[model samples]
Every structure is written in C-alpha cells, then in structure tokens.
Target chain A: MLDSFYVAWRYLAFHKARTATLVACVTLLAALPLALQVLLEASERQLRARAEATPLLLGAKGSALDLVMNALYFADAMPAPISMAAQDQVDASALALPIPLYVRFQARGFPIVGTTLDYFDFRGLEIARGRPLAMLGEALVGAEVAARLGLTPGDGLLSSPETVFDLAGVYPLKLRVVGVLAPSRSPDDRAVFVDVKTAWVVEGLVHGHADLGRRADDSVIIEQTEGNTIASAKLAQYTEITEANIASFHFHGDPAGYPLNAVIVVAQDAKSGTLLRGRYLNGESPHQLVLPGAVIDGLLADVFRIKRVLDAVIGVVGLATLLALALVFTLSVRLRQREIHTLFRIGCSRFTIARLLGAEMAIIATASAGLCGAALTAVHASSDELVRRLFFG
Target chain B: MIRIEALEFSYPDASLKLRVKSFQIATGEKLALIGPSGSGKTTLLNLVAGILLPQRGRIQCQDVEVSSLGDRQRRDFRIRSIGFVFQDFQLIEYLHVLDNILHPYRITGALRLTPQVRERARTLAAQMGMGDKLHRPVDRLSHGEQQRVAICRALLPSPALVLADEATGNLDPCNKGLILDLLFASVADQGATLLAVTHDHDLLPRFDRVVDIAEGQSRS
Candidate 1:
C-alpha cells in the first residue's frame, strides 16, 4: 500500500501542470467557503459582543435592522429621532438608565457619536491617549478612526455632511480632537465620540453667532437684555456670546422639539429590562424599545438564511468539483489505457493498478486541502481590517 | 511450463472462431509462435496470460488450471508466474525508465530484488543499450528504448514465464536484434520460459522450438 502511494505521488508529480491546475481549482473551491464562514462567524461574534454589553435600545419606530444598525453599530442614519423628553422619561423610571446618542454627521468617513460620558463607561471603553470628550465641540477619536485619519490630541477635524460627497463638501463645524481611545476591537473603535449638545449643534438644531457691525459696548449691552423678544431690525443675523443676547441665542423651541437619534438603556437587571420593554410597547409611549441582542439575532437569522442558500450553492459547486475530478480521472484512465496494459504486462495486478491510481488522487487532495486550510487560517488571523474595508465601506 | 488443450475463442461479433488444440511449452525453454496477421497469435498469448478465459477446454500453467481460477486469483497467479511484453512497447509513459522496470515488483509487493536480479536487469539493459537511460521518463525514450524498458519490466520479478506478443514488431532491424538478444539472455539468466509471438521468420531460429499458427492449427 505504501509503495502504491509512492507510485501515485510520482504519477501526480510527473504531470506537474495537470496536478497543479486541479489542486488550484480545489484550493480555491475550499478556501472561499472557509473564508466566508470564518468572516461571518467573526462579524457575528463582534455584533453579539456589542449587543450583550447594552441591555436595550430605544429609538423611533422603524426597520428593526436599521434601528439595530444605528444604535448598535452606528453604521447607518437613524430614520427618526426620539426626544430628550423621552430620555428623561426613561431616566425617571426605576427600570433603566437612558444613555442618549445623537448621531447625524461623519468625520473622515467614521460616524460621529454624540453621547454623554456614560456611553463610554457603559461600553467599558478605555482612553488610550488623552481624556474622553469633556467639553462641547471637543471629541475623543476611536482607535481605528485615529489610526486611519492620522488624528491625535490637539488636532482638529471638520465635520463632513450627513450625506458625504465625492468632493470636499461643506464643513459645518471643526471638532477639536481631545483624546484617542485604546484599541477596543469594538464598534467604538470606528466612531468619534462627542457630547450630545455638540452633535445637536453640528446638526443645525442649535445655532450661535456673534452680533456683527455693533460696537463692542452696544453688543455687550444687547447681550445683557433679559427679554425673549429680540427686535427683528436690531437683531443681527449672527449673535455672539454676551450677557444680553446670549439668552436670546438660547434654544427657542420646546425642549421636546430637540430630538435624539436613539437612547441606549442599561437596565438595573433582567427583570427591569422586561419591564422597560413592556412600558415602551404599551402603545402609549411614542418611542419603541428593543433588545439589541434580540434584534441583532433576528437580523443574523435572516443573514444565516441567505448564508444557507449560499452554502447550498457552495455544496452544489463542491459536488460539481468532485464530479469534475471523477471525470478528469476517468479521462485520465482512458488516456492511459496502454499504460495500464503495460502494468498488467509487467506483472501488475488490476487491484494494484487501481490502488496506485487511488493513491495518486488521495495524495493530491490531501495536500491541496492542507494548503487551502493554511491559507484560510492566515486570512482569518488578519481578517478584521480586511472585512471592515470590504463590507463596512 | 504451459499447456493448452483445445482452446477456442472468438470476438463478440465474430462469425468465425480461432482454435488451438494440444499446445504445450516445456519449463525453461524458449518457444516462438510465428504467424501471419489475424492468425490469433495475440489471442493465444492473452489466453495463456489469463487476460482472457477460453470458451472451451483449459489452459494449465505449471499444472494449475488457469481458466478455473477466479478473477482475483487469476490476477495474482498472472502477477506471480507470468510476465508480458507487448509489441507497442506499452511502457507507462508517465513513469521513468527505472520505475517502469520496477513496476512488476511494485504490483506483486515483491520489491526485494537480489543483487543478482538487479545485476541481470542492468546487464540486460546494457545489452539493449538502455543502461544510461534508466532515470529518463519512458515518454522521452525512443520506441526501441521503450521496448527494452518493457522487456526489463517483464523480467524484473523473474516470473517463471515471459510472454511477448509481437514484441519486436515495431522496431528497426538493429533494435529488433538487440531486443531479441536481451529477451533471450534475460530469460536464460532467470531460467524462465519464453513464449514469443512474432511474424518475423528470421527470429524463429533463435528459439528452442518453432510453432506456426495458421488456419487455427499449430504446425511445428
């Protein structure tokens, strides 16, 4: 048997071109599915880990996938915004601690997340360089964002439009980079964190300007005026920080009108989570509450269904590959009929000849599988950035 | 030793049959079967090699009935006792010359070649002028060199009998002489019997016995 195997190895090695072609076909066939499986598994693991960290998500009623992508991954825009009043309502409840997230802009292609310091604490994100987002318009860059954008503390980044453009479009505000987070290997690593007020300001929900063309003394006097009413003729198009008109620059609409993208809730316990979900679904609350893990699971279930179809296709292709191999072997046997006859003439039994052929196939398949497996492992080990670039982009 | 008693065979669509009655070759003797084309010389060799079973009567190799054995047993028996060299120089083209010569041993699990057997193969190859070409692939060799490799393979395991079906049929005059000399010399070294089927009348005198197969009869 060993001798037969050696003979088979020699036969495959003798025709290096045919053997290499077959091996390459088999290797690619094997590697594609293995790589896809590994990537899907890794993405699911990361999503699940993120979901498990947050107990529940609160947002305006919309597609559950969209809500999850917005709240958990910060990858997409929130179609509707929940109110800060809703956050206050949730915070007043004994069931949960509402963490408001206001996201509506991008910085260098990474999402700008406007939330309080509790968001970082809840997600267990650590500061790698400088401090966390401390003041308005000041930001902490995620590790990936910092590395990719070459950002550091004391550097500044202009907020890109919600809908990015090919050319350098209008920049609403410049965010001062105050800190960089350590590599968390989480979604946070791809986001820029700022105060929710700053996010609202950047979204044009709030505006501030200096009163131009007024003498400095007059401007200071107008800024100190205490009335809500501003004389339309005297009010400059832009207002500055002064004791009088600074009050006029304050938010004019009802506080409820300032909407939040979403609120992440950390429940006191599992019981509170159930209660909180029940309160939101009670048909009275305008907002929708969801378990991020459950929503992500549902999304993954849909993805897995598609993966199943892909797997079926891969299975059929694999079968076809085997059939192709068989066809090649059959054609090979036919082409080598004279050689087989020669073996028989040289005192080789039919069984030995067959074993020799089988050994040749087994050797090629085993070596190809090994090579493909090694390639898959290497890809998997270095897949994080590759997958992010391919899919998240 | 080989014995054939009233052997009869025909192709599946044949309207006529080829027949052989009472043919035998003694141990250690070189016998030649000479005939015109379509005289059933190759068919007789196939029957003796157990590649085909006779439809009538029996073939006995060393007193064991060849036709009576099952397919597996017959395969083993052929591998252990009989060697064949085809006129086409049927050396497996993918194998090197040395590996082709060692093919029979690879099959029979009889890789143990005594120094004498190895020396005999090398000496026979040298006589055939193929000793320098052992490591080369058979496909790269000339038709004559391939024939010499086939002969060396046939004689590798020192089988009790070597069957050649028009072994030198495709060779040039000089190659034919070298192949015949090597064939006879190798068989003599192993003290193995030779049953060669050929159409070349000039080669007949080299054999210890000459049997002509024509019109389904052996005329000695």
Candidate 2:
C-alpha cells in the first residue's frame, strides 16, 4: 500500500499541470456552493435578527419591502415621506415607543439617518469613542462610516447635495461629528445618525434668517425686503447651525407636519401590538403597520426559491465535473498502461494497481475537501462585509 | 533447478502453437535459449517464471509447481524466487535509480525491505558503475546505465533463478558484451541459474547449454 501511494504521489507530482487543473476543478465544484450557502445563511441571520429586534414598522402604505429596506438598510430607493404627525399618533397610542426615521439624505455616499436619541437605546447602539448625539446639527458616525471616511468624533461631515443641477436648491448642511458608534455588523455600521429635525433642515423644511439678523441702521428695511437685509448668494443660506444662530432656525410649515420616511415602533406587549395592528387595519388608512419580521420572512422565502434553483444548477455542474473527473481518471489509466504492465511484471498484483489509482483519487478528494473547508471559513468570517459591499455598494 | 514436460501453448487469437515434450536445466547452470523473432524463447522464460500458464504442461522451478499455481500465488512465488530482466529495461521512468532497483521488495510482502537490502542495492549499483547515478531518474540515464539498473534490480532479491529476455537488444556490440559479462558475473556470484533468451549466436558459446526453440529442443 505504501509503495502504491509513493508511486501514485510521484505520478501526480510528475504531471503538475494536469494535477493542478484537476484539483482546481474539484475545489471549485466543492467550495463554490459552500461559500454561497454560508454567505446566504449569514445574510439571512442578519436580516432576521434586525427584523426581530424591531417589533413594528410604520410607513406610508406602499411596498413593505421598500419600507423594510429603508428602515433596516438605509437604502437609497426611499418611499414617499409621511408626516411627523403619524409618529405623534403612534406615540400617543401609549402602547408603543415610536422612534421616527428620516432618511432623505446622504453624506459621502453613507446614508445620513435622522432619528431621536431613543434610537440609540432602542437599537442598542454604543458610542465607541465619544458621546451620542446631544444637539441638533451634531452627527454620530457608525464604525464603518468612521473607518471608511476617516472621521473622528471632532470631525465634520457635509451632506451631499440632492441635485447638482438645482442651483437654487437647499444648501448642504455641514454637520459636526460628535461621536463614533461601535461596530454593529449591520446597516447601522455604515450610516450617519443625527436628530430628525436636522434632517428636516437638510430637506429645506426649515431655515435661519438670510442675513442672520444683521441690518443696516440707516437703511429703512422692515420685514418686507429681499436684498435690503439679505446677504450674498454664498451666505444667503445657513450652511451650519451653531449655538449663536440656532435660535433663528425655524420651520417653514407646521413642525408636526415635518416629513419622515418611516417610524420604528416597539410595542409594549402583545395586546398593544394587536391594538397597533388594528389602528392601521382599515383599507382606507394612508399608513401601514408592518411587522418587519414577517416581511423579512416573506422576502427570504422568495430568496430561497431562487437559491434552490441556483443550487440545482450547481448540482448539475457538480455532476458534470464528476463526469469529467471520471473521464480524466480513465484517460490516466489508459496512459499508464505500459507502466501498469511494468508493475505487474515486477510482481505487483492487480490489487496493487487498483490501490494505486484509488490512492491518487483519494488524495485529490481530501485536498479538495480541505480547500472547501478553508474557503467556507473565510467566507463565513467576512460574510457581513461581503454582503454589505455586494448589496449595499 | 527447472523442469518442464508436455508444454503446449498458443495465443488466444493466433494459429501459432508451441510444443515441448520435456526439458530440464541443472541447478546453477546457465542456459541460453536461441530462437527466431516469433519463436518461443521468451514464452519458455515466461512459463518458467509462472507469468504464463501452459495448457498441457507441468513446469516446476525451485521444487515448486509453477504451472499449477493460482494467479495470485504465482505472482507471490515469482517475486520470491524468480527475477526477470526485460528486453526494454522496464524501469519505472519516474522513480530514481535506487528506488527502481528496490522495486521488487517494495511490491511484495514476501520480500521485506531491510537496511541490509538497501545496502546490497547500493553495492550492486557500485559494482554496475551506477553508484554515482543512484539518485538520478531512470529516464535521465543512458541506455547502458538503464540496463545496468535493470541487472541490479534483477540480482537484488538473490533469486534462485534469473531470467534475461534480450536484455542487451538495444545496446551496442561493446555494451552488449559488457552487459552479458555483468549478468554472468552476478549469476556466478549468487550461484543462481540463468536462462537467457537471445538471438545473438556470438554469445552462444558462453552459456553451458544452448536450447534451440525453432528446431524443437524437446519433441515427444
């Protein structure tokens, strides 16, 4: 047996290119599916955990998937924004804690999520470096956001302009980074968080005085003027709100009607959850109460349906690879006919020849399985980052 | 010692048949089998080594019935008792010279590979002028060196009988004589009987006896 193995190993080593090609074929057939399964399961676990953690979601009646994506992923395809009065209504229910989420803006490709202070406690977000958001115009950067943008607690982030073509559009807000949150291994890891009102300010729902309350003493300008008290186009809009000018910032409309993309609701108990569901049960209701867990489960069912088809296609490919392997083995045996004859003439039995072939195949298989194991572990370890870059990029 | 009686052999798909009524070689005797290209010189060697089973014959070598043994038993018996050197020097190309010489002991449990056996292989290589090339692959060596390696392997087991099938067929006249000298020297040193099949009559006078297969050395 040892002699056969030595010969087999030497034969494989002798044919370096053929051996490598065969090993690579087997590794791909073995590892690709395993890596895919690991990534998908990790994604499923992350999606399910985030969904289960948030008990309820309130958004304008539309696609529940979009609402889930916006609330959980801070995805760019935002649904229609609903008024803050809906959040007030859910809060007035007294059966759930409603945390408002306004996600209409981004900073350096990272979503700038505007929510209340309770969001940190609700989502179990911990500030890794500095304190949480304590004032308007202050931003809390997630771990990934900080790492990718190299922004520390004392840094500042300017919101991206909604449209470069809209010259008269709302000026981008320059937010002061107050803190950096620890890694959450979720969408939050890549987002920037600020008070909801700051987001409203970014949406042009509020503004400070054009000249910031400066007026010429001799000029007769009394509240009916355009350029009488206005500053230049550059200084016409407040790029940032500080303690000195914060008082002048005022909403253009009723503050209750401020738009929010979605509201995450944590029900007090089962009965309150039922009552909350009942509140939006009517077909005529403009708002929708979504159980994020149920929505995610539905999405996963569809995802798994596609996964099953992919697995079948992979199975066929695996079978074809196996067939090709068999052909290669047969060709190897045929090519070594004279060698086999030599072995036989040297008093090696037919059993020994069979053993030699078996040893060669077993080595290939064991090495491929080992490669698959290593690849699966690597994919599993980096699955969160992989999904984030792949889906969210 | 070797004895054969009533040997009848033929290929499964050919009309040619080989018949021998009786033949014998004494212990430690050197016999040269001379025949035409298609004659039964190599076939007789194969029968004696238990590599081929005769249809109606009993071949006994070293007091064991070679014709009556099973395939597996014949293989074991052949490895333990008979050593064969082929016309083409059937050395595994991938194995180094030392490993090719030790091939017999590696294949059979009947031959245990010991430090002594390895030492003997090295000594044989040294005697055959292959000591410096022991680590070289068989395919890397010259034809003469590969033939020397074959002879080294054949003699390594110290078999009771040594069979050479046109071992010098590919060698030049000078190298051929040198290879025959090596084979005879090894057989004499080990007191092993040698049955060599060759078409060269120039070397016929060296052996103790000449068996002509075309003329029917033994006919009933």
lDDT of 2 by residue, B10-115 (tens): 9797656889998898889998888888887887888888878888989999789999999888998888788889889988887899999998887677789999
How well is each residue in A1-393 modelled by candidate 1, as lDDT tens digits? 877887888888889999998898788889888888988888788778878777888988877667777777886646587789889988899688889987778877888898999988888889999887766678899998999999999898878775556333333577888899999987789999988877776675555554444535443343435454343334343212223433434454776668788899889988998888888787766678888888878877977898899999999999999899889989998988877876765556777888888898788889889989899888888677665554344
Model 2 per-residue lDDT at A312: 98
lDDT scores in order: 0.79, 0.87
Error of 1 at A165 (Å): 6.0
lDDT score, candidate 2, position B168 = 84
Name the lDDT of candidate 2. Answer: 0.87
**DockQ for each candidate?**
0.46, 0.58
Residue A37 C-alpha lDDT in model 2: 89
Residue range B1-220, candidate 1, lDDT tens digits? 7898988888888843778888889999999888777778888888888888888989999978999998777777787778788888777666788777776666666455456756767776776678898789888888888888888877766689999988999999998998898889888988999999988988887888888788444444
Which stretches of candidate 1 lie above 4 Å from their native place?
A14-43, A83-85, A92-95, A146-169, A172-178, A198-259, A268-286, A308-328, A375-393, B1-30, B53-77, B110-127, B188-192, B205-209, B215-220
Error of 2 at B212 (Å): 2.0
Measured by TM-score, the strongest candidate is 2
In Å, residue A244's CA in model 2 sits off its true spot by 4.9
